[model samples]
Target: MSIPLDSPALALRAALHAALVADAALLALLGGPRIHDVPPAEADFPFVALGEAVVADWSTATEAGTEHALTLHVFSRSGGRAEAYAVAEAVAHALHDAPLALAGHRLANLRATTAEVRRESDGRTFHALVRFRAVTEPL
Candidate 1:
């Protein structure tokens, strides 16, 4: 079935972006509020970018809801994986079980599911992939 025009996933994403940008802990790790849906070609190192998001129907007999599998990418050129991992920890601490306000949906639950940090193919850049799982119900 086709998804509704006013999708909860969109609302959830907006909320996530706002929350991440406003989180002081996460911002400090990045040296600024460098959170973006798509980073520019010259974006500074040690920044967080919104990555993939997979949405699925999670409706009950009487309730409409959604399940979101979201990924946030952390990029850094710092000497080692330490910086990337630190940023990932801040991201997880800010989001896990946090109450977020969405436009037309209520966040039922949000949790940091997984995080992985590794050196990219370039061999200099460190990449941290932080994944989150969230459930939202339309308001």
Candidate 2:
């Protein structure tokens, strides 16, 4: 299909969202398909939510490209950080180096960059932040 010129950031975000929801490992970790771009209120525990994203110009002299730094958040209520970390691991494993079909863009590369698991200020919720770095070129 021919996709017209579009924002590479949005295209990549859509592709990432679709890929996360479709991963069996991530689904198993979350106990269901609970990945969301904007999670609903009263969402269940141990779910994944799309978080902050930063996109920057990566154009060359004759080529147009973009660099994306995206983050995914895992929320859990387990007694410890283990559950949150596990969910984060699943997310990283599912996304790193995985081939994703993006509209109006071609994925040059995607890689898990960093992760941090900590207890929320409420002291009951464990939050895991997983970040990824990706590059895309206009298709």
Candidate 3:
């Protein structure tokens, strides 16, 4: 079942979306990727996508309340800086758009700090820590 847009979950999703949209360089990096699918699971939120040469899996903590973390994983046929940034951008945008459903959730605060970009044999990956404060009242 989907939670109401006013729920805390929706608030968190919105904060994530804002964070991704705020970064242009990140967006450019993650361009031309297709959103494969999103699965419903506890603990981690996953968005799967297919890039030019790789498949990326971005997972983040979807816990309700305050202080959450997000991780992006890139799996590619070849590894490069451009590929890494692209994956990061896509993941960021996904998070930014995540909260579009929450209309009534009040965004008390949102802060995206602590960003890390890494390169591996598979591809490049970016990790970000997103902190937000929101409140949802019963109707």
Candidate 4:
């Protein structure tokens, strides 16, 4: 059955964890040799390692159906926007190629709405607000 976005805390947490794992795996697959290591503190973003990840909020609407919003907090330790955007593009590509099985859920489709990069205070760190839709066959 389809579970409402606000259905339960445990379910949401489980979904978030699964998504995180899938994201990490995708990044690893793309980063290849560059995939050095992911720090613990970097989990604050949606796609960590080359960047961090965070699930801001999600909700279900009758008009649009189901939607999930997330932010990728990328830290350009090297202080380069190009590098950060490249990392973001890699993440977007990975997410676009991610399969439902990878998410451990029967997702009908996943679409990336936006992937713009923004600068933080230090200018070395950037944040990418990657919004996407996750369609599933019921729950």
User: Judged by lDDT, which candidate is best?
Assistant: 1
> 36-122, model 2: which lDDT tens digit per residue?
888899998889888888888889999988999999999999889999999999999999998999997899999999999989999
Task: Kindly indicate the candidate among 3 and 4 with the higher TM-score.
Answer: 4
lDDT, candidate 3, at 105 = 46
Report the number of backbone clashes for model 4.
8
Candidate 1 regions off by >4 Å?
1-5
C-alpha local distance difference test of each model: 0.92, 0.90, 0.38, 0.48
Spell out the clash pairs found in candidate 2: none
Worst 10 residues of 3 by lDDT: 50-59
**Ten contiguous residues minimizing lDDT sum, candidate 1:** 1-10
Against the true structure, candidate 1 reaches a TM-score of 0.95
Candidate 2's clash total is: 0
lDDT digits (tens) for residues 3-88 of candidate 4: 45543322333453455455654456334323323556544333344333333234356422233444443445435566666666
Off by over 4 Å in 3: 1-6, 18-28, 32-78, 82-102, 120-139
Candidate 4: segments with Cα more than 4 A from true spot: 1-39, 42-65, 102-105
